[model samples]
Each structure stands twice: as C-alpha cells, then as structure tokens.
Target: MDMATTESTASTMSLASVTLEVADPEATHRFLTAFGVETYVRLRASQAPSTGFRGFTLALTVSRPATVDGFLDAAVNAGATVLKAAAKTLWGYGGVVQAPDGTIWKVATSAKKDTGPATREIDEVVLLLGVEDMKAGKQFYVDRGLPVAKSFGGKYTEFAAGDSSPVKLALYKRRGLAKDVGVPAEGAGSHRIVLGSTAESFTDPDGFAWEASTSSARP
Candidate 1:
C-alpha cells in the first residue's frame, strides 16, 4: 500500500463505546444491570433539556425468539415501559421498550422459533441514529472514514466496525425510525447520547456528538 493509504487505513475511525447521558447515573446503572446490558453502555449525569423522542434507539439482536422475550421481560421488569410487545413479524420476533431514563431499546431475533432454551446471550448491539436526511447522514459518516457495511437505498445505512468493537453504528430516517420504535419524530434539544470513537471529536450533520475514545473511558 502507498504511504498515504497506509496512514489513512491506520487512522480509520472505529466506534469504541457509547455513553448514555441520563439524570440519575446510579439508577440507570442499576436498571442496565438488571436488564443485562450494563457493560454495553456507560452512563453519566446530564440534565440537558430533551423531550419526545431522542432521535435514536439502541438495539439488541439475539439468537432466537425466546431470547427476545428474555430481554424484553427483563427490561420491563427493571423500570422500562413497553412500547411494543414481543411479536412475530415477517422478518422475526421483537419488541420495544423505553427505559426510565428515556433511552429506547429494541430486542429482536431473526429466528422464527427457538431451538433451545433462552439465555442471556446477546449476538449484537447496534446504535441506530435517526437523522433528518438519509443521504446527508450517510455521506457525513462516509466522509468521516466509516466504511459502509450495508445500504438500503436512501432509507438506511450501516457502517463497518472491528470485530471487537462494542457497538455497531447505523443511520435511518427519523420519521421511519420513530414509527418503528413507536414514538413521534419531533424532538429537540440535546440527543443526550455521546459516541466514543478512535478519531478526533466532531459533531455529525444531525448533531450527534463524537468524542475521543479516551474521554468515554473516564469514570
């Protein structure tokens, strides 16, 4: 590879972590622990004014329908309000819940039926941001060095990340995403979530903030 190409590849940004800014960090931590995703995201206290939808949803993909139930039940029991009950769909079975701290979570599985008993195993964790413009959002991430892993016309886009990366990042249309998660598309103020990346800090076109990976590691 040429020197410039080598340097660019070496510095390509990767999602390192996700921090959910909440009102009560301790309570949110306890809730996450009960919901079996404490390690997937960190929490911090931020009283930023926000209302309606936060323009994003964090998703958990599991092995089977049963696993989806396990997560949904756990989250609901741990102070989450059910937005959508677990049900079978053309693609799979899934459900949506909003945590007490205002974060939306969706648990889903591609398998139509369970081959075994449910477990706490999670196959993937995805952070999906709802943006005003799909093409613009896709281009913004592309310009920042996030290679496209998958694209569905102008409706959705997913970015490639290292195998060890804690979270996968994706973009979707705001109104469509809100419909899928059972919320309204109108929201203002802070997104109340921060992304940690290997690249330098910058805000996306939709106002999603990214920070140096080290800052997210702080306690």
Candidate 2:
C-alpha cells in the first residue's frame, strides 16, 4: 500500500474507533488491547480521568446526569434507545445505549480532555463475519481476488479490497459473534451495513452477509 501523500486542500478523514459492547468487559478489553490499541483505562471513581480517544472520555456510575440526558435525547431523536441512563457515580457520569442490531454502547463524560489525535472520518466500512467454516470463507475471499492481510490460524482472517480510503475490508470468526450482534447463526443473510460511504455487499460461503460503503463525511 502506498503510504506517502502530500497535504492537499481536500480535507481527509479516517476511522477513529468502532466500539462494541461485549458480554465480558475484561475479555473485550484484553482482545482490543492485544488487537493494537496502545492504551486502556478502566473508569472507576467520581473524579473524571482522561481516556485515550480524542474528544471522548469514560466514567463509571449509576444514574443519568443532565448532560447525559441531552445526549440520550439526541440519540433517541436519531432512533436509538437509552439502555441505561447516566448518573453521578464514584467515578463520573455514565450511560449505555442500544444501537441497531442490539449493539450496546457505553457513553461517558468527564471534565478532563484526553483528546489523543485527530480521527479520520471513516472512509470505508469493514464487516467482520463469523463463519462456521473459516477455511472455506477464507478461500472464498482469496479466490475472489481480495487481498489477505494476515490469518490467525484458521480462527481469524482479514482482507483488503481496492476500495481504499482509510478503512480496509476484513473478516473474522469468533464464538458468539452472531449472538452479540443480535443475529441468529442462520440469519446471516445478505444485507447492507451502511457507513456513510459507498454501499457494497458480499456473501461468504457460510451464507454470512457483509456490506460496506462511503457516505457523507462527519463534521
């Protein structure tokens, strides 16, 4: 991949992070840490602390604060459910939201700014597919001419397509992935996963559907 580029008038944006709720927070943290996030901080007490993500912070607490209520209202207006409300805590204010497909989001706010780095608005969407047969799916993508990045045994694999902006296309398989996304194992039919980009869809051998696209850039 070409890594060199000259700064131009056209603004460039890239994906910052894709947060997901897991059944086990500790395990999720460990997986992400091993997957390449350089730092991790567990929110605990009432004092606000800095998280590594830019423009975002995390706190641990029970009820919804006014600020969190406003945030929830915005999200609700946009069609999301308030899974949990933010409230004062030993650490700070925290809340949870349920996005489409049962995806849970943990939202927190703190007085400290831990803005780490400028994030590129997502250029592409990567759909991670969990399959009953990893080898077959891997071969399917390989035979289709998608570029393979790395394979963690037959358990995990990532691929890249030509539709590059910043985010690359990839797939992976793990136990309970389908359940986490609120889809049945047999319900992995072809469908679209929109991400403010060009829309593209693919169906793997195990009937698992994946989609990607580019849309309007985030402000």
Candidate 3:
C-alpha cells in the first residue's frame, strides 16, 4: 500500500506495525500468541545459533532461504547476543535466533496462496509525553481545539479530537513519567519518533517532545 501523504490527518492513516526489542523468541512468541497474535513468519531455524522471526506483516512477500543465514551472520557481527537458534516452525516458516537487544527480525514466505485485496484493521498510535508544566500544556491543547477527556493527578492529562476510533494527545510530568515508563527523561528540544500513521508531534513550553497520533498498540 502507498504510504500516507504528508498532509493527511489521523483519520486518513492507520498504524501498520511496531518493531520492538525483545530478549527471548520462544517466550515472546508464546506471549504474543496468547495475547491474540497467531500469525508469524519465521526467518531462521531453531538449530542455528543466531536467528529471528516476523510476528506480523502488513504486506505479504516471498521468503528467501539465503536471506536467513545472511541476517544471522550480520546480526552476530554487529554485537547481538543470540537467545534462540534458527529453526523452522511447524506452521511452515523459518525463525532464527533471538537477539539480546529484544529485537526479533523474521524472514518468511506468505502462507496465503491467492492474491487478493488486503483486509485488516489498523491500530491507533499513542504518544507518551513529558512536560515541564502540565497545567499550561493542558490549556494549550484545550485552546487549540483539542478537548481533555481524563486527568490523572495534576501531572498527567489526555486530550482528543472527536472521532469514531479512539485517538488521543496526552501530557505528563517529565521525571515522574520517565520513571514510570522506564525511559530516560528528555531535557529539552525536539525528539522525533516516527510511526506508520500521519506525522505529528507535541512540544511542551520547555521544548520537550510528545508523540501525537493514534498508531500505538497497548498490551
């Protein structure tokens, strides 16, 4: 599918996929599957020292066996510790070694035999923001045509423009939020985090960055 144009709004685009860093392949795979992600693409086999797997795909593609070995070697050389060796799954795709960095890369062939129109629901993106002044930031969005839906203490706030699907803009205190989410707090200035939906961002008065969009998945 074509990427969303630059000027499109949140309603015009949807979240396609998210790549996460993980430590274990088997455990991660099992966990995601239990959480309702059954589709997967194995990029390597369980026997190999280094490998990866693709949990979900937006578009189907043919799998190449050579790509698997090359990916493993490249990952090892690049300093990734292998958690699980590459191996083929019973479902028909190859999965490779899991990386210590918590990132799993899978290469696999599409199981669907027929070519047809793509049909799937896209996810909303969520931004975790760190702000210096919560009250002021909340007021800015309220004045700019966004409405607050929820407030947690004086430190966190959620705002949104009306729509059928849930899309929100939020604000939170920097240090406290950082500690809660396990991310280092940004001092100031813009920090860009890209996603599959329309490009958007929020800036606190202190210049801290906040993601703005509905392409994030919460589990």
Winning candidate number (lDDT): 1
Worst 10 residues of 2 by lDDT: 50-59
| Candidate 3 steric clashes | 27
Name the candidate, 1 or 2, with the larger lDDT value. Answer: 1
- On the 0 to 100 scale, the lDDT of residue 63 in model 3 is 38
Q: Tell me the TM-score of each prediction against the true structure.
A: 0.93, 0.39, 0.35
Give lDDT tens digits, candidate 3, residues 104-161.
Answer: 3333332323244322321232344556677787666555445465676667766553
Off by over 4 Å in 1: 1-11, 216-219
lDDT of each: 0.87, 0.40, 0.40
Descending-TM-score candidate ranking: 1, 2, 3
What shift in Å separates residue 202 of candidate 2 from its native position after superposition?
Answer: 7.8
In model 1, the Cα lDDT at residue 10 comes to 33
Worst 10 residues of 3 by lDDT: 52-61
RMSD, every candidate, angstroms: 5.2, 15.8, 15.8
lDDT of 1 by residue, 1-219 (tens): 112111122327878889999999999999999999998898878999999888999999999999999999999999999999999988899999999999999999999999999999999999999988888898777777887777777678888766546789989889999999898899999899999878899999899999988884423
